[model samples]
Target: MDEIITRLQRIENLLEHLQAERVSKEFYSIAEVAQMVGRSEYTVREWCRHERVRGQKSRVGCGGTTEWRISHAELLRIQNEGPLPIAKRFG
Candidate 1:
């Protein structure tokens, strides 16, 4: 019983460490965020443009290129609360 308890504690510690390392990035691309939220890329893009969720947009190109990046913290927010109370997009 004691050995089983020690093994369970080790497993718990490993799980916690893995969870922390899972979100290593400060920001995530629209596609990545979509995968995390199980939503379409188009939907995530709209969320960024519509301020449903906070994101940083980049459009530095002659061809009018645009890309959105969401911070890990913002994604966590979205996970905790549905996208609402429109936030101002930045960058």
Candidate 2:
């Protein structure tokens, strides 16, 4: 009975530690973000090229190669903003 109580207490302590730890959501790569938004990777690249949105290079995973990271909040903002309007010219 005492051994079981000790094991339970240990488990409770571990759970508390886990609950206290802060876990951050990792930024997604441009390709991953493109797929997430249901658009081609090139289109995302173009957006970045035109400065339509902000992104940065982040080294995630192995190989030490940096990839473009888009903020989820920024993506949602862009999505909410909708597509750009077409320009009209008058002669």
* Global fold similarity of model 1 (TM-score): 0.64
Whole-model lDDT values for every prediction = 0.87, 0.71
lDDT of 2 by residue, 49-68 (tens): 56666777778678898767
Query: What are the clashing pairs of model 2?
Result: none
Q: Considering every candidate listed, which one attains the maximal TM-score?
A: 1
Candidate 1 per-residue C-alpha lDDT over 20-68 given as tens digits, one digit per residue, 9 for 90 to 100: 9876698889999999899999999988888888999877569888789
Give the local distance difference test score of model 2: 0.71
Error of 2 at 46 (Å): 1.8
TM-scores of the models, in the given order? Answer: 0.64, 0.52
